[model samples]
Target chain A: MRKKRMINKFTLYISLVILTFIFLFPLVWMLVSSLKNEFQIFRDMQSLQAFLPPAPADVEGGYFHNYVAAFQRVDLLRYIVNSLIYTIGIIIFGLIVNSMAGYALARFRFPLAGFWLGVIIATLIIPPESIFLPLYVLVYDLGWVNTYTGLIVPFIANAFAIFLFRQFFLDFPKELEEAAKIDGCSQIGIFFRIIVPLSKPVFATVAIVLFINHWNDFLWPLVVASDESMRTIQIGLQYFMNEPPIKWGQVMAALTVATIPMLLIFAFLQRYYVQGLTHTGSKN
Target chain B: MKGNDSSAEKLENERHFHQTAKKPQLKPTPPPRKKRKLKSQAFREAMTGYFFLAPALVLLGVFLLYPMGAAFYYSFTDFYILTPDDVSFIGLENFKYIVEDAQFRQAFWNTVYFSVIVVPVQLSVALGLALLINKKLRFRVFFRTAFFSPVVMSLVVVSILWTFMYNPNEGLINQLLQTVGIPPQPFLTSPDQAMNSIIVMSVWQGAGFQMMIFLAGLQNIPNHLYEAADIDGASSWQKFWHITLPGLRNIALFIFITISIAAFKLLVQPMIMTQGGPLGTTKSLVYHIYETGFNYRDVGYASAMAVVFTVIVLVITIIQRVLIKEERG
Candidate 1:
C-alpha cells in the first residue's frame, strides 16, 4: 500500500510537470527558434541533433538582425509610441471620468440614480463586438480614421470601469467627506483633496486594468487605424504576419519586442491585477 | 385701585399676544434661517453630482447606445460603407440568408461545440488545481504565478507561439507524443484536430484565471465548516460534496457564464493560428462575421450575423441568469 501511494505521488508530479511544459512550450520554442537561423528553424525535426545553439554561420549576426529588420519593416518604434499614447490616453480619461461617475453614484442621492445604475450595468452584458459595425460607421463619419483621438476617444469611458470604481467607492467612509464638507470646503474641493487621495488603491487597479486591455488589444486597432503611420503595435504585427508569405522568424522577433512592454507592465502591476480580480466578485 | 389692577392684567395679556405674533410660527427664528442655508447647500451638492456624471453619460450614449441603435438599423437595410447614399431596405433577407448559408451553420456549431467542450473541462481542472494548491504545499506561490502568468500574456502572442508548437514536422507536441510511443497527431493541420488543438491551447492559457477565482472561493469558505465535518466523521468525498461544492456554486456559475461567452468569441486564436482552416473547422461565428464584413465587404451579411450572434449570447446569458435565480430562490 505504501509503495502504491508513493507511485501515485510520483505520477502526480510527473503529470503536472508535463502539463506545465505544455503550457510553457510554445513560448519557450518561440524564444529558442528566434535565436536560430532560417535553415535551423525550418529544418526537419530529425535533422536537428538536440535543442542547442545553432551553428555560428546559421546564427550569423544572430537575432539582432531580425529584430532590426522587423523594426525597419513596420517602423516598430512608431508603433510602440502610438500604442503607448493611445493606451495611456484611454487610461487617464477613463480614470477621471469613471471615478467621478462612480463617486456620484455611490455618494449622492438623486432622481433616477438607481435607474441609471441599472442601465449602466445592463450595458456590460452587451458585448462591444455587437456594435463594431456602427461604431466603424460613426468613426468614418467623423473623419476620425487613422487618428489617435479616434482610437482612444470611443473607449475612454467604459462601463466596466464605472462598475469597478462604484463598487470600490461603496465601502468608503462617508464621514470623512462629510467632515470635509463641514470645514468650509466645497464638494468638488473635498472630492479632489480627500476622496481622490483616499482612493489610490482602486485607482491603481482601474489604471492597470485599462492599460492591460489597451496594450494587448488587436481588434479595434485593426479597424480604426488605416494608415501605416497610425498603426499600433498589435495592428503592425498582424499586418506583418499576414502581409504575404508569412515571415515566422521576423514575426516572432517583432512579437517578442512588441510583447515585452506589456509583460514588464504585467509583472510590475500584477499585484493590483490579482487584487482586482480577487476583490471584484466578492461583496463583503 | 381694583380697576387699575384689572387694566394691568389686561396689559400683561396684550403684551404676551404681541410677543407670540412677532415670532415665526414653523420654527424658532435663528434655526429656521440656518435650515434654509443647509437645504440650498444640499441642492447645490446634488446639482454638482449631475455635472460629474454628465461626461460619462454623454460618452456612453455616443459610443454604446447610439452605435447599438445604428447596428440594429443597419441590420434591417443594405448598409454599404463605400457609398452612403445607396442603403436600401432589404427587410429580413440578410438574416434569412444566414440559415441558408452552409458556412454560417458550421461556424455556429463550431462555436457551440467549443463552449460545450471547454467550459466544463476548464472549470473542472481549475477546481482541481485550486484544491491541490489549497493545501500547504511547498513552492505554491511559484506554481500559482507560473500558471497565471499566461493569463496576462497577449493572446496574440500566445496564438503565434502555439502556431509554432502546432507545426506538424518539428512541433514539440507531436515530438513528445512520438517519444511516448504514440504516432504523431495531425494537431492543427487536419480539420478534425484543429479545433481541438485550439481548445487545448485556450484551456492551458485560460484555466489559471478560473483557478484563481476558485482559490478565492475556497479561501472564503470558512475553515470551521471543514472542522465541523471532521467532528461529524464525514468522509472527504462527503465533505467536498456537502461543503466545498455548495460553497463554490455562485463562483462556479460566474465562471461558467464568463467562459461560455469567451469561448464563443474565439476569433484571435483561429485568426492567428489557423486562419480558420484545414477546411475552416476552427472558424467561429465572430471570425466569420469579421471576414464577411471586412474581407468580403458584405457588411449587410456581417451585420445580420452579428445581430444573430448577439441574440444567441444574450439568450444564453439570460438563461444562465434565470437558472441561477431559480436555484437561489
Candidate 2:
C-alpha cells in the first residue's frame, strides 16, 4: 500500500507539472519569441528552443529590437498613452462618482433613495455590450466620437462599481461618522476627511477593478475611437496585426509590453484580485 | 425630554427603525431647541445626498438608461442607421424576420455550443485543480501562479497568440502533436474545428479564475466533516461526493450562471481569429449583430438581436437568483 501511494504521488506530481507547462508555455513562448528575430524564431520553433532566449551573438539588434520596432512600426506608444489616459480618467471619475452615490444610498436617507438604488442594481444585470449600438449612436449624435470625452465620460459611472461601493460603505462604522458630525464636520467634510481615509482598501479594490476593466476594453473603442490618435493599445495591436506582413517577434514584444503591468499587479495584488474574483463573477 | 433618553434607547431606536439596513447617523442634539435644528439639518443632509449623486445619475441617465431605452424602442421599427428619418413603427417585424433568418440561428447555435462545451469542462478543470492545490503539496504556489497567468492576458492578446499557435503549417501545437505520432490537424482552418479551437483557448484562459473561487470554497468546507468521513471509513471519492460537492453547491450555481452569461456574449474570439469564417460556423451572436448594425447599417435587426440577447441574459440571471434564494432557505 505504501509503495502504491508513492507511485500515485509521483504520477500526480508529473501530471501537474505537465499541466503547468501547458498552462504557461504560451506566455513563456510569447516572451521568448519576442527576443528572437523572425528567422531564428521559426528556425527554433519545433524544439524546446522555442521557449528559450536566442543567444546574444546570433541576432544583429541583440534582444529587444522588437520593442523598438513595435513602436516605430505602428503608433504603439501613442496607443499606450491613450489607454492610460482613458483608463485613469475612468477610474478617478468612477471612484468618486460611484462611491459618493454608494455612500448616499448606504448612509443617507434622501428622497427616492430606494428607487435610485433599485435602478442602479437593475442596470448591473445589463452588460455594456447589450447596449453598445445605441450608445455609439448617442455618442455620434453628441459629436464626441473619437474624443477622449466620448471614451472616458460615458464609462465613468459604472453600475457595478456603485453597487460594490454601496455594499462596502454599509459595513463602515456609523459611530465614527457620527462622532465626526458632532465635532462640527459638515456632511461632505466628514466624507472627505473621515470616510475617504478609512475606506482606502475598498477604494483601491474598486480602482484596480476599474483599471483591469478599461485597460482590456476593446469593443467600445473599436466602435467609437477608430481614429489613430484615439486608438487604445488593443485596437492598435489589432490593426497592427492585420496590416499584413505579420512579424511574430514584434507582435510578441508589443503584447509583452501590453501584458507586463497586469502580471506585476497579479504578483503584488493577487489577494484583492482573487477576492474580487470570488465575490464577483469573472467579468472578463 | 429627548436628552433624558438613555443610550440604550438610542441604540434600540436605531436598530429597530432600520431592521434590514444600517441607519444614517443622526447628530447629537443640545439641551435647548433641538427639534427644529434637527429637522433643518436633516433636510440639508438629504439635499447633500442628492448633490453627491448628481454626476453618476446624469451619466447613467444619458449613457446607460437612454441608450437602453433607444435600443428597445428601435428594435420594433425598421430603424436603419443611414435612413434614420425613414424609420417606421413596424411592430414585431424584426423579431419575425429573425425567425426566418438562418445566419442569426447559426450564430445563436454557435454561442450555445460554446457555452455547453466550455462551461462544464472549465468548471471541472477548475474544481479538480482546486482539489489538488487545496492540499499541502510541494510546488503548489508555483502551480497556482502558472495556471492563473493567462487570466492576466487580454482576450485580444490571447486570440492573436493562439492564432499564431494554431497555424497548421508551422505552429508549435501541430509540431508537438506530430512527435506523439498524431497526424497534423487543421485547427482554425476548418469550420468544425475553429470554434473548438477557440473553445480550448478560452477554457485555458478562464478555468484559472474559477479555480481560485473553488479554492476559496474548498477552504471554507470545515475540516471536521472530512475527518468524520475518514473516521467513518469513507473513501476519498465518497467524501468528495457527499461533503465536498454539497459544500460547493451554491458556488457551482453561481459559477454556472456567470459562465453561461459570459459565453452567450462570445464575440471577441471569433472576431480576432477566424473573423467568424469557414462558412460562418464560428459566427457568434454579437459578431453578427455588430456586422449587421455597423457593417450593413441594419440597425433595427441588430437592435432586435440585442434585445433577445439581453432577455436571455436576464432570464439566466433571474434563474440563478431564484435558485440562490431557494438555497438560502
Candidate 3:
C-alpha cells in the first residue's frame, strides 16, 4: 500500500510538471526568443537552445537590438500611453458611475427600481460584437472617432461592473448607513463616505478587470481609432503584424513588451482577480 | 334676572355649536397636508435615485440600446458611411443578399463549427486541470498561476505569438513534433489545418480561465462527501463521478454557456493569424461582418448580419436560461 501510494504521488508530480511546462513554454519561448538575434532564432529552432538567449554577436548589437528595432518601427511608447489613458479613464469613471448606480438600486427605495435594474441586467445579454457597426456609426456621428473620448466614454458604464457593485452593496451592513443618516449625512454623502471606502475589495476587483479589459480591447479601438497615433498597444501590435517581411525577433520583443505589464499586474493581484472572475462565473 | 339667564344660555349654546363645526373640518384638512408631505418625500427620494442612475442609464442607452435599435434600422436602409446624404430604405434586401452570399454562409458554418468544437474541448481540459490541481500538491499556487497566465495576455498578443508558433518550418510546435519523429505539418497554411490550428491555440489560451472557475467549484465541494465515499470503499473514479461531477454541474453549465457565447464571437484570432485564410475556412461571422462593414463599406449588409447574429445569440441564451431554470426546479 505504501509503495502504491508513493507511485501515485510520483505520477501526479510528473504530470503536473509536464502540464506546467506545456502552459509556460509558449510564454517562455516568446520572452527568450525576444532576446535572440534573427539568425540565432532560426538556427536554434530545432533544439533546446531555442529557450536560451543569444551569445554575444560581433556584428549586431546582440540581444537588445530587437527591443530597439521594435521601438523604432512603432511608436510603442505612444501606444502605451494611449492604452494607459484609455484604461485609467475607464477605471476612474467606471467605478464612480457604476457604483453610484449600484448604490441607488441596492439602497434607496424608489418607484421603477426593479424595472431599471432589470433593464440594466438585460443589456448584459447583448454581446458587444453584434452592435459594433452601429456603435461605430454613432461614435462617428458624434465625431469622436480617433479621439480619447471615443475610446473611453462608451465603455465607462459597464453593466457587469454595476451588477458587481450592486451585489456587493446588497451584502453591506445597513447599520453603518443608518448611523451616517442619523448624523445628517445625505444619501450621496453616505455612499461617498461610508460605502465606497468599505467596498475596496470590490473596487479593486472591478478596477483590475476593467483595466485589463480596456488595455486589451482590440475590436472597438480597431474600428474607432483608425489614426496611427491613437492606436492602443493591442492595435499597435496588430498593425505591426501587418507589416511585410515580419522580423521575428522584433515581433517577439514587441509582444513581450506588450504582455509584461499584464503579467506583472496578474502576479500581484492574482488572488483578487481570480476571486472576482470566479465570483462572476458563479453568479451567472 | 330672567332675561339675563336666557341671554347667557343662548351665548353658551352658540359657542359650543361653533367649536363642534370647526373640529371636523380641521381633522380632514390636517391629514391631507401630512399625506402631501409624505408623498413629496417619496418623490424626492425617487428623484435622487434617478439622479444617481442617470449617468449609467444614459450611456447604456446611447452606446448599447440605441445602437441596437439603430442597427436594426440600418439593416433596412442603404446607409453607407461615405455617402451620408444618399440613404434610402431598402427593405430586407441586405438580409436577402446575406442569405445568397456564399461567404456569409461559409462564415456562419465556420463560426458554428468553431464554437461546437472549441467549447467542449476547452471545458473538458479546464475541468481536467481543475481536478488535477484540486488534489493536495506541492507548489499548487505556482501551478495554478502557470496555467492561468495566458488568460491575462491580450487576444491580439496571443494570436501573434501563435502565428509565429504556427510557422510551418521553424515553429516550436512543429519543431517539438519533429523531435518525436512526427512529420512537420503546415498548420496555418493548409485549408484543412488552419481552423484547427486556431481552435487548438484558442483552447490553450482560454482553458485556464474556465479552469480557475472549475477550481473554485471544486473547492466549494465539501470534502466529507469524499470521506463518506472512501468509507464505502469507492474507487477514485467512482468518487469523482459521484461527488465531483454533480457538485460541479452548475458551474460546468455556466462555463459551457459562456464559452459557447465567447466562441461564437470569434474575430481576433482569424483577423490576426489566418485573416480568414487559405480559403476562408477560419472566417468567423464577426470577421465577415467586419470585412463587409468596413472593408467592403457595406454597412447595411453588415447590420443585417449583426441583427441575425444577435437574434441567434438571444435565442441560444434564452434556451440555456430555460434549461438551467428547469434543472433548478
Candidate 4:
C-alpha cells in the first residue's frame, strides 16, 4: 500500500512537470526564436537548438539585433508611450469615477441608487464588439479619432470596476464612516481621505484589471488610432505583422517586448490580479 | 416660593439658550425652520450621491448606452461610411441580407462552432490544471505562474507567435509532430484545419485564466467534506463527483458563460493570423463585422450583425442568470 501511494505521488509529480513544460513551451519558443538569427531559426527548427540563442559569430548585429531592428522598423518607443498614456489615463480616471460611483451605491441612501446600479451592471452584458461600429462613428463625429481623448475617455468609466468597488465598499465597516462624520467630514471628504486609503487592495484590483484590459485592447485601438503616431503597441504589432516579407526574428522580438511589461506587472501584482479576478468569478 | 420661582425661571432660560445657540434662527418661528433645514440636509446628501455617480453615469450614457441605441438605429438604415449624407431608413433589409449572405452565415456558424468546441475544452483543461495545482505540491506558485503567463500576454502577440508555430514547414509544432513520426499538417493554410488551429491556440492562451478561477473555487470547497468522503471509502472519482463538482458548479457556470461570450467576440486571432482564412473557415462574427464595417465600408450591414450579436449575448446572459439563480434557490 505504501509503495502504491509512492508510485501515485511520483506519477503526479511527473505529469505536473510535463504539463508545466507544455504550457510554457510556446512562450519559451517565442523567446528563444527571438534570439536566433532568421537562418538559424529555420535551420534549428527540427532540433533542440531551436531553444538556444545563436552563437556570437553567426549573427551580424548580434542576438539583440532583432530587438534593435524591431525598434527601428517601427516607432516602438512612441507606441509604448502611447500605450502608457492611454493605460494610465484609463486607470487614474477609472479608479476615481468607479470608486465614487461604487461608494455612492454602497453607502448613500438616495433615490435611483439601486436603479443606477442596475443600469451599470446591465451594461456588463453588452459586448464592446457590438458597439464598436457606432462607437467608432461617434468618436469620429466628435473629432476624437486618433487622439488620446478618443482612446482614453470612452473606457475611463468601466462598469466592472464600479461593480468591484461597490462590492468591496458594501462590506466596509460603518463605524469608520460614522466616526469620520462625528468629526465633521463630509461624505466626499471621507471617501477621498479615509475610504480610498483604506481600500488599497480593491484599488489595486481595479487598477490591474483596467490596466490589462486597456493595455491589451486591440480592436478599439486598431479602429481609433488610424494614424501611425497614435498606434498602440498591439496595433503596432499588427501593422508589423502585415508588413511584407515578415521578419520572423524581428516579429518575435517585438512580441517579446510587447509581452514583457504585462509579464512584469503580473509577476509583481499577481496577488491583486488573482484577488480581483476571483472576486469577479465568485460574485457571479 | 420665591426661591422655587427663581430656579424654575433659570431652568427655562437655560433651555431657551440651548435651543437658540444650537440653531441660531433669526426667523420668529424656530420649529418649521429647523424642520426645513433637516429636509434640505437630506436633499443635500442625495445630491452628493448623484455628484459621486455623475462622471461614470455620463460616460456610460455617452459611450455604451448611446452606441447601443445608435447601433440599433443604424442597423435599420442604409448608412454607408463614404456617403454619410445619403442615409435612409431601410427597415430589416440589412438583416435580410445577413440571412441570405453566405459569408455572414459562414462567419456566424464558424463562431458558433468555435464557441461550442472551445468553451468546454478550455474549461476542462483549466479545471484539470486547477486541480493539479490545488494540491499542496512543491513549486506550485511557479507552475501556476507558468500556466497563467499566456493570459497576461496580448492576444495579438499570442496569435503572432502561434501563427509562426502553425507554419507548415519550419514551425516548431510541425517539427515536433515530425519527430513523433507523424506527417506535417497544414494547420492554418488548410481550410478544414484553420479554425481548429485557431481553437487550439485560443484554448492554450485562454485556459490559464479560467484555471485561476477554478483554483479559487477549489480552495473554497471545505476539506472536511472530502475527509468525510474518505471515511466513507469514497473513490477519488466519487469524491470529485459528489464534493468538488458540486462545489465548483457555480464557478463552472460563470466560467462557461464568460468564456462563451469572449469566444463569440473572436476577432483578434483570425484577424491577426488567418485574416478569416482559406475558404473563410476561420472567419468569426466579430471579424466579419469588423471587415464589413471598416474594410468593405458597409456600416449598416455590419451594424445589423452587431445588433444580432448583442441579442445573442444578452440571451445567453439572461439564461445563465436564471439558471444560476434557480440552482442557488
Chain B alone, model 2: TM-score?
A: 0.87
Candidate 1 has an interface RMSD (Å) of: 2.3
* lDDT digits (tens) for residues A65-170 of candidate 1: 7687777777889989999999999999999999999988988877778988898888887878777878888988898988998899999988889988898889
DockQ of each: 0.49, 0.53, 0.74, 0.70
TM-score of each: 0.89, 0.92, 0.94, 0.93
Specify the CAPRI tier of model 4: medium
| Tens-digit lDDT string for candidate 2 (B251-327) | 88878887888898898999999999889989999999999999998888899999999998999899888998888
Stretches of candidate 4 off by over 4 Å are A54-60, B1-34
Clashing pairs in 3: none
Candidate 3 TM-score, C-alpha based: 0.94
Clashing pairs in 4: none
Tens digits of per-residue lDDT for model 3, A1-284: 99999999999999999999888888988998888877888878888888776666533675678899999988999999998998999999999999999988987889899999999999999999989889998899899999999999999899999999999999999999899989999988988988888999999999999988888899998999899999989989875677887889889999998998898888798778887988987786
Model 4 per-residue lDDT tens digits across residues A1-284: 99999999999989988888788988887898888778888888888777776777787777798999889888999999999999999999899999999999998878988899999999998999999999999999999999999999999888988999999999999999999999999888999999999999999998988889889999888999999999999999876678887899898999999989898888799899999888988998
Q: What is the DockQ score of candidate 4, to 2 decimals?
A: 0.70
For candidate 2 chain A, the 10 contiguous residues with the lowest summed lDDT are: A275-284
Q: What is the lDDT of residue B266 in candidate 2?
A: 93
lDDT for each residue of candidate 4 in B94-171, tens digit (9 for 90 to 100)? 999988999988999999999999999999999999998898889989999888878978998999888889889878
Per-candidate TM-score, chain A: 0.91, 0.95, 0.95, 0.95
Candidate 4 chain B, run of 10 with poorest lDDT: B22-31
- Per-residue lDDT of B249 in model 2: 89
Ranking by DockQ: 3, 4, 2, 1
Winning candidate number (lDDT): 4
